[model samples]
Target: MLHATISGNVVTQSTTATNHSILAFLTSTIGQISPARIRVDNNTVINNSTSGSTRGILVDTPDTSTSPSFDATVTNNSVAIGDSINGVSGLVAQARKASETCTSLSGNTVTFPNGTPSGIQGLRARQADTAVYDLQTSVSCTGTAATVLSCLNPSATTEVLGTINTVSPGTCLLPVTP
Candidate 1:
């Protein structure tokens, strides 16, 4: 899709399935070019599964080429993750190609249950290519149940830039407070 706007929606999953509840992406086949501009705002995502890895919201461009560009804005979204064995992230924005990818995340909230196991990320921004990828964030939280830093993905290629309230510990630039 070239352009899309998704707002004010509620997505809930209460099963053991492992998948992304809300996903917006742009993919290309071979030499095809698929540039996308997407806006996701004011959405509520709740995951009540007790097993497997899952994502509440995912926005990504998986095509690894310079011909495809991606721009996304995710704001004012509420995400909740339940018990899981593997990595379960509340919100994720990724650019997996050597393209111009820009993602902005602001005013989002994520909640994890108490005693949440390891590999649970409240918010994550990743850039897996050597392109012009910029990820910005502001005012995001993981409630009072989990540590904000521990709930973030620490990758060498990933950088979370912007204003965020710190709550707990691990290794992150901006930590979110409840």
Candidate 2:
């Protein structure tokens, strides 16, 4: 995905997921390297599991010599977990160079039925100003109400579900709107 929809100085890449369920999934990655100016909107990923290995979406660019990638957006995607998927990421981006920018990751949701396995993150970004990414709208649903939940004591009389998780805007980098 190398900026296929470029007109003059403007470039864009876009994808959407609507009314779909991904079951018994087996993939190391879903989306990768869609150039600068990309969008992923309104998709559902359900019941997906791997042998402790898999990534949902990767927004990245390898062109280290040019100006930074701009305006990458991921929005409104939902991921429902299966069992014991470790080190999985719902969204991740890499910007190694000083001039690189991350764009945005917004309005995405990840529901871990039994709670996310160890070392897994609902969303993450690396090597760029957190300002370039929008993690605020993303969420995680855990605990008893989740599709598959476990308890420390199976015979416990009452259960408490986990709370929803939201990313705070200022926690990333300098506060800047993308």
lDDT of each: 0.61, 0.39
Residue-wise C-alpha lDDT for candidate 1, range 11-37, written one tens digit per residue: 888777677888976677666666777
Looking at candidate 2, the ten consecutive residues that score lowest on lDDT are: 5-14
Q: How well does candidate 1 score on lDDT at residue 91? A: 84
- TM-scores for all candidates: the values are 0.69, 0.47
Clashing pairs in model 2, backbone N/Cα/C closer than 3 A: 17-42, 17-43
Winner by lDDT: 1
Badly placed stretches (over 4 Å) of model 1 are: 63-67, 84-87, 136-178
lDDT of 2 by residue, 1-178 (tens): 2332211121111122221132111111223222244455565555454444444555554343334434445545555545454535555444543233433444556656676667665655544422132222212422322211112112111111223122333222322323
Query: lDDT value for candidate 2?
Result: 0.39
Clashing residue pairs in candidate 1 (N, C-alpha, C atoms within 3 angstroms): none
